[model samples]
Target: MLGAVFVGINAWLPLDPLKFCISHTDCKLVILDAERAEKLEPIVDELYAEQKVIGMLVVNAQEGKGQWRRMEIFDKALQNSAAGSPPLEEESVLAEDEALIMFTSGTTGLPKGVLSTQRQFLTNVLNTQVGPRRAILRRGEDLTPPPAGPQKGALIAVPLFHVTGLTSYSMLATMAGMKIVMMRKWIPAEAVKLIRSENVTLAGGVPAMVSDLLDSSLVGHPLEGLFFGGSPASELLASQAQVAFPTARLSQAYGLTETNSVAVGIAGEDYMMRPGSTGLACPVNDMVIVADDGRVASHGEIGEIYLRGPNVMKGYYRDPDATSQVMTTDGWLKTGDVGTMDEEGFLFVKDRIKDIIIRGGENIPSLLVENALYEDARVREAAAVGVPDRRLGELVAAVVSLKAQYGGKVTESSLIESVRKSLPPFAVPVMILIQEKPFELTPSGKIIKSQLRKLAREHWELRQKNIPKSARANL
Candidate 1:
C-alpha cells in the first residue's frame, strides 16, 4: 500500500508509476518518515498525479529502536495517501492494466519507463517456480518440506524496482500469501540478521548479492532455498553455496525484462549437473533457433535465442520500431543471446554476438575470462574488455577485485600466472587492473563493461600524460 521509507532519498526515477499503481490498488495508505518527508514530498508530488487528498502517517525513521523509524514512515505515508486523495476515477486504463512502470538501469543514457500490466505481473509471478517447490530434492530423491506456517516465509532484500526482485522472485513470494520482509535499505549484515530472526525460507538475489552473502556470515544461517538471476553466477560460487547451505537449493537462471522474468531455470538435481548451462526451458515457454541465414540451427549448434510464450512481453511501450526489431511477424522474440542446445535440450550460452571481442585475429569471450578469474579464492569479481593496442589492433584487459584475505593486493603478474596455468596464452588478459573495490555493476549484477571500458580509457590517458615526450619518441 504505497508504504516506503525516506522515499525522496531513493530518488531512482523508475519507481513512480509502480508505486502509484500500488497505492491506487488495494494498497491505499502511504507511510513515510517525517525527516524523509521533505525529500519524499517532491517524489510523491511527481508520482501522485491525481488532484485528491492524500494522507500521511509520519514517524522518525532516524530515531527510535529497530524498525520504528521505517514503521512510522510507512504508517504516515499510507495515512497521508488515504486521507488526502480519494480513489482515482476510472479512466480508459484497463483494470488488468499498468500494474507497474519500472525504468531500465539506463546503461546507454537515461532510464526509460517499462510499463508492466497487471495480467503481465500476475503471469510472471505464477509462472516463476520460486522457493522450494516439491520439497528440497537431494541426491535425486525428494526431501520433506520445511515446517509450514510463518517459518516457510521468504525474504526480499533486493530493491523493489528491479525485475528479479520485483517481478519474479519477490513477487512470487508475495503472491503465495507469504510474509515479506526487507530492510529500509540493503545492508548485507542486516539481511543476514533478518534471515536468522525471520527464519527465512528462500532468499533471491543476483550473483553479486549472492557473492556478498557468501562473503558474509549469513550463509551460516539456515536457508532452504537460494535462487538468483539477472546475472550469471560463477560455477565456483554456486558450488561453494551448495556446500555452505547444504539444505538450501542453490540455482541460477537466465532472463531479461522483455521476457517478463525467467524463461529458463535449472531446478534441483539438474542444477548441479549443468554447471554453466542456463538450465532447461521453463514450462509454457518455447525456445528455438534462427540461424545467420534465416534457417534454424541444428541441435547442438549455436544460434540466436528465440522465444514464444505468454511470458514474452507485449512489446516496448510507445516504441513500435524498437518492437519490430526484436519481435518477428510470426511472434517469436529474438533474444540477442548466442547459445546452443544439447541432444537432451539443455542450453549452453556461448556468447553474445554483440559482446564478442576480436583482438589480433583472436576471438575473446569476456564471460569466459570473467568465469576463470572468479574461481580464484582471492578474486572477488572480474571483468574483461578490449582496449586499443597498436600492434594487436585490440588487446584483452581485465579489472579485478581481491578478497580481504589477500590484503587488497591485486597484481597483473599474479593474475597472469593464474590464467596461464589454466587457459591458453592468447586468452589471458594482457593488462590487469586491481580495483580497490568490485567493478561497478548494473541493477541486475552484470559487470557494466562499457563503464569499465570508459574508466580504463581514462586511466590509460592519464598514464600517457605523465610520460615524458622524449620517452614516447624513444618507445
Candidate 2:
C-alpha cells in the first residue's frame, strides 16, 4: 500500500536465508504473521543491529510478542493511522524505480537477489502476451476465452514469494481486477474445491501440481486458462491435462528471476506441436542461441540461450561483480540454459550449462537421461543428477519417484535397464534411487536436483563405510 520497495521471501525458509534476505537487500521494516515472528525472534538482534532494521510489524501481537518484542502491532498501527491522519499523499514513483528484490537459485540454499523495476515486470507480462500469440504462431489466434462470471478468479497454489505467484499471476490479475484466490500451499484436493466453489476460470500451477490435481479431480472444471512456469510441462503431462480439461487453453513459460519471469512462452496448439520446446521469444526481446564456439547458432543446434529485452532485470541487487558475470556488454544476458532453437523459433530446453555432466570428457545432458527415465511406465517424477566419481570425475545418477501403483515393487535395476535401452551406455544412470515420494520441490515447483545428488553421494559413502577394509580392497 505504501509503494515501498520490498523483498519477497519464503516464510518457511530457515534463519540463514531470512538473515541474508534482510541484510543483502538492506530491508528496514518487516511484516510477519505470528508463526514467522516467533522464528525470527532469535535473529531480531542481528536484524536490528547489523542489518539496520528499524522494527517489525506483527500480525498477531498476542502470539508474536512472547519472545519477539516488536515495536508496534500491525492492526493497531493501521487503526491509529486511519483515525486522525490527513489525506494520503502519493509518492512520485517512476517505471524505473526499484519495485522488488526477488531471490532465486536456492538449490544449494544460497539465493541471489534479483532486482526488478515496475516497468521490467510489466514488460515480462507483455512478453507472455506477445510470445504466446506472436505472428510466428499466428496473430490474434483464437485461444479459449476465460470463463465469464461476476468474479473471474485465478488460483495461486504456489507461495506468493515465488516469481510465478507474484509477477506472473497476482500482479497481472490485480491489474485486471480479477479475483485472486490464494492457497497457503499446493493441496490439489483443496485447490479443486476452491476452483469449483470460487468459479476459478484462470487456474494454473506447476506440472507436478497439475498431475496431483488430475489424481484428485472431481466432476467439472471451470478452468479456461491454465499456465505453467518454473519448469517446462512434459509432453505426457501436457497431453494428459489437455485430455482432462479440453476447454482450458494450456500455456507454458520458461524464464528466470533475472528475466522477471518470462523469457519465452507457448500456448494452445503451438505448445502441443513442439513436444518439449519452451517456446519462442516475444518480438520486443532479442533471443539468440549462441553455440559453444561463441557464434550465433543455426537452427537445430544446441547452445546457450541469450536474451535481451526491457523485461530483463536492472541487475543483481548490490552485486555488480556477480551481475557482470551473467550480463554481457552488448546487452544480452547469457542465460545458463542449454537449448536448441528450431527454424520456427521455438526453443527446446535440454539442460542447464552447469548441470551438463562430463564423464571422461564425454558431455551428457541430464535432460536426456531424465527424459529416458520418464519414458518408463513405472517412473512418475525423475531427476538425473551428476554424482562425484573418483575415476570419471562425475557419473550419471538418478533419483526417481514411481507412479503410486508401481511403488515398492519396481527395482532400481529395472529402471536402469529401461534407460539403457533409450540412451547411450555413458548416459545411463549407474545408480538409481527409487523412492515413493515426490522430489522435494522449490517454491516454483522445480525439482531440487542438488538434493538428489547429495542423497546419492551419502548412500554411496554409507555403503563404503559399512564395507570391511579387506572386502573393499577385494571388490
Candidate 3:
C-alpha cells in the first residue's frame, strides 16, 4: 500500500514492526494487520494517551471486539469513503519532495532513518532497468527472446521492507508489468516450488537464498537468471552456483540502503571471470575509492568507497549531525565499506571497517579468511572474528558449518589447514569451531558476526578451563 501511495502525492514511511516503536515515536496513524494490531494494542494505548497516535486502522480482522471494536476497520473505511464522495483532485508533488523514510538495519547500533525523495526512488527504478542491458553487453551476447506464450514471472522471496525487495524488485516488476509471485516467508523448498508452479524466470535475494536454492532438490528448475546483493558472497559459492545452474545467468550486485540498492553489478561471463569482485559501477552512479588523507586512491589500492548519484538518499531523517558525518557537502556519501577498484573499474569489497579483525597489530580482513574457509568443499558456511588474547592482543577465530554429507569426516584441524594454505600464518585462524547447524542470519541473510564472536570467545574460554594448567600455557 505504501508503494502504491508513492505514485501519488502522499509520502509513506514503511516501518519494521519489531524496530518501529523503539526507533520512531512520531507516528500519527498506524495501518496494520490483525496480528500486529493485537501486539501493538498496549503500546498504542500509551501512545494514544501521549497524543502521538491519532487512531489505529486495523485490516484483515474477522471479528471486532474489545480494543479492536473502538478502532476503525480498514476495509470499511475504504468502502464508506468510496460510497459517500467523489475522488478529490490530486495534490501536486515535486520530485524533490520527501517520499520515504527507510531505517537502516541497525546491526551495529541504533537504526537511522534514511530520507529519500520522489526523484531518488524513480531514479533507482530507471537505473535498475539498465542491469539487463549491461549484462548483455558484458556477455557480448544478444538479448535472449522470451520463450513463446506466457509473460515472464519473477519470484520475490525477500521481505518487502528492504530496499532491494521494494524498489529494486517489486517496484521494478510493477513498472515492467511482469507477473510477481511473493513469498510470505523465505523457505528455500517453498521458493523452488513457486518458481516451478508460477513459471518464475527471475529469482534473487541474498547469497544464502541462492545457495540454498542451488543445493536443494530442485536444482534443475528453469530459472532464467539469479542475482543477489545486500552482502558479500563467497567466490566458492559463486563457482558452485554457476556450475549448478548452467541455464540461469548468475549475477551479483553491490550497493547499500543509502544508494537505493545497486550501485555496481556483474552478470553472465563477466561475473564468473572475476571471482570476488562486486563488478563495475552502474552507469547511473559514480564511485571513487578515497584514501584516509582524502585523495582518490590508485587502482587496486584499498580505501573507503564514496558514491555520488541521483539515487543516493536525500539525508538521514531529522538527524543533521549524523547526515553531515556520512554525507559530504559536495554530495558524495561515504560508504563505510573498505574496498578496491581495479584499472578496469571492477570493485572488490574487502570488509566493513568495523568487521576487520586486528590480530597482533596486523589488520586481517575477516572476509578474506572466511572466503578461504568456504573454498573447502565440506564447509557449508563460515564466519571469522578476532578474539582477545593475553599474548597476541587478539587472535583470529573461525566458526564454520559443514555439509551434512561430510558430517564427521571434516575436522577442525583440517579446516584450519585449508585456510592456512591460502592465507599468511598469522592470518590463519588460531581456533576453528564447527557448528552443527547454520549460523544465525539477519533478515537480509547476513551472518551476525558479533554474535559469532561472542560465541567463539565463550567456547575458547571453556576449552581453556578443560585443559591442564601446564597445557593451557601452551594454548
Candidate of highest lDDT: 2
Best by TM-score: 2
Residues forming the 10-long window of minimal summed lDDT in candidate 2:
466-475
Q: Clashes per prediction?
A: 26, 0, 0
Worst 10 residues of 1 by lDDT: 2-11
Per-residue lDDT of candidate 1, residues 290-346 (tens digit): 688888889988899898777776665555666787889877888877898888777
Return the TM-score for each candidate structure. 0.60, 0.73, 0.71
Q: Which ranges in model 1 have alpha carbons more than 4 Å from their true place? A: 1-96, 105-108, 130-150, 353-475
Taking all chains together, the TM-score of candidate 2 against the true structure is 0.73
**Model 2, runs deviating above 4 Å:** 1-3, 60-67, 106-109, 131-149, 355-475
What C-alpha lDDT does candidate 3 achieve relative to the native structure?
0.73
Q: Of 2 and 3, which scores higher on TM-score?
A: 2
TM-score of 3: 0.71
